[model samples]
Target: MPDLSHPAAHRPGHGDPDWAAMRRILVVRPDNVGDVLMTGPVFRALRAAAPRAALDLLASPAGAAAASLLPQVDGVVTASVSWQQLDLVPGSDPDAELVGDLAARGYDAAIVLTSFSQSPWPAAEVARRAGVPVRVGLSKEFGGGLLTHWVPSPPDEEHQVDRMLGLLAAVGVPSRGIALEVRVPDDAATPLAVVGERYAVVAPGASCPSRRWPAERFAAVVRALAGDGLTVVVSGTERESDLVHAVAGDVGVPLAGGLGLADLASLLAGAEVVVANNSGGVHLADAVGAPVVELFAGTETVDQYRPRTTRAEVLTRPVSCAPCRQLVCPFGQECLAISPDEVVAAARRLRAVHV
Candidate 1:
């Protein structure tokens, strides 16, 4: 097996910092929505470390939406342009342009988070060019030369939220245990009134098809929960409305596309329980401190990636071909065939414990 722990060249480490004196900081987490959401603790830890520092975030558009609801992030910048779009284009100075734009913000330091498979060097290079003085990240590529401090990536495949907290720890920021937190704006708070006192949110879609439980199975879970007298609010993006509609038609209330990210957070925040696949919504619910019933299809390891919260209950079926990480299942999806009754049972058990 290849050594996956080394950082790529040009990546920097968490340098020696005067925690009290660091005033302006930038966090680069231009990944998926869930990845951005998981970085919430890092933002909080940074704030706890330097209570007066202004924190800004660099993320993709969707990630930016999630970041906007985080109280710890004072400002957000979207890096929507993909690496291929800019890097493959001949004579395009997109990297330089991005660096200049970030440099204009005048951040004193930055922290870049990367998984074993992802190289932090590219983002580190951008931060360096942006003139950020103290850059911090894992040292996988002998890139310690570029960083002021280099911390080893944790060997355990912990939850992404914990992984980000580890990065904060490297920079002298204390972790707030391992939990997700999001702020809901005033306007988003209104939708919660419609959900009433007791309701369950059903998120029926995942970014990858292989991770999604079958739509009908989700419908069954919804119907069962609804039959127990809990209102089931179906949630998904506008693109996922059709699937939400199909599930809602068979099971619960159709609130598809009616909630923005902030509204979704508000709704999840007030819910008694959230039923979702191993998707962003699960992480969002965890962030809001809502109890979650997570259905896993085995493409991703639930042990490693499941939300880090005591309120979360995960259900997975063991299969030899699990963790294949396939986008589309070629064979019949044996991984998702865990009986709907089993899911319902898990929900009932959770509800029982909470009651």
Candidate 2:
């Protein structure tokens, strides 16, 4: 139960002369959907700090999809380079063209948000090439030479959401009491009729294999919930049909590949609860105000990225090597081997609390 508020423990002085003159601002957060969703509070904070200033975002395709649902953003610019792919080709300069494109817009200032391990150099380089007047980011990689303002990276154990907000505070933005948000378009509300009301959503797929609880475990949870006379619907992208089908093999209705992001949001909005892995769906469920039961398999710290809502229940098994944060588990994934009955019990507890 770590505190997510008060991101900046050591507030820096706003002594920069140009801080007041900056008008148009750009935020670069080319990460995953969850990462982008977590930044919504920061985006809203930026809008509140500069009510009249135009704010733009540079994100990846997935990040852009999530950003489009945020109300504070004036526009989202899709970055051609993926962070994972960029790491593969360290010196390719694929972002060079994007820098030129952003330069043409003539942003007055920019802030780049990144984790402790990731250097903000790429975004800093783009800001420099774009000729943005004031560039702000966390001080790492000894690359402060490229930034106009620098904030120290938060301690390693700090929640990532707080860490991003720490960078925002470095540039005179307030970072307290903000909540995550997402906008579901009116048109996106149509397909949710298929789920009906009083249903639960089961998101059985995760981007990382180590993060996925066993498909059979999901099936058991679904079966138990269905047996309790609740309507259960499973949802995932088209690519995850196989995994979703495997999870729904023995219980409930298989709604796999049945909804897009917006449709999924609409459906989730109507659900009593959402049972999912520590994946994008966890954030989506939180966005729509659905109580979520998020299963964390020790791939990452539960406190760092757990859904930022009181309605959510995070379950993790304490293994000796838990929270290794590895892409692939060297040994069998014991962290996620908790019995299906245990997950169902947790889900039931969450449901009772919400009730």
State the lDDT at 209 in candidate 2: 82
Worst 10-residue lDDT window for candidate 1 reads 6-15
lDDT of 1 by residue, 191-299 (tens): 5455567788889999888888888888998899999988888888888989998888755777767578988888888777888998889888888888888988878
Q: How does residue 205 of candidate 2 score in lDDT?
A: 88
TM-score of each: 0.90, 0.90
Native-referenced Cα lDDT, model 1: 0.78
How does residue 253 of candidate 2 score in lDDT?
67
- Candidate 2 RMSD computed on C-alpha atoms after optimal superposition onto the true structure: 3.9
Off by over 4 Å in 1: 1-15, 81-87, 189-196
Give stretches of model 2 more than 4 Å off: 1-21, 86-92, 190-193
Q: Which pairs clash in model 2?
A: none
The total number of steric clashes, by the backbone 3 Å criterion, in model 2 comes to 0
CA lDDT scores, all candidates in order: 0.78, 0.77
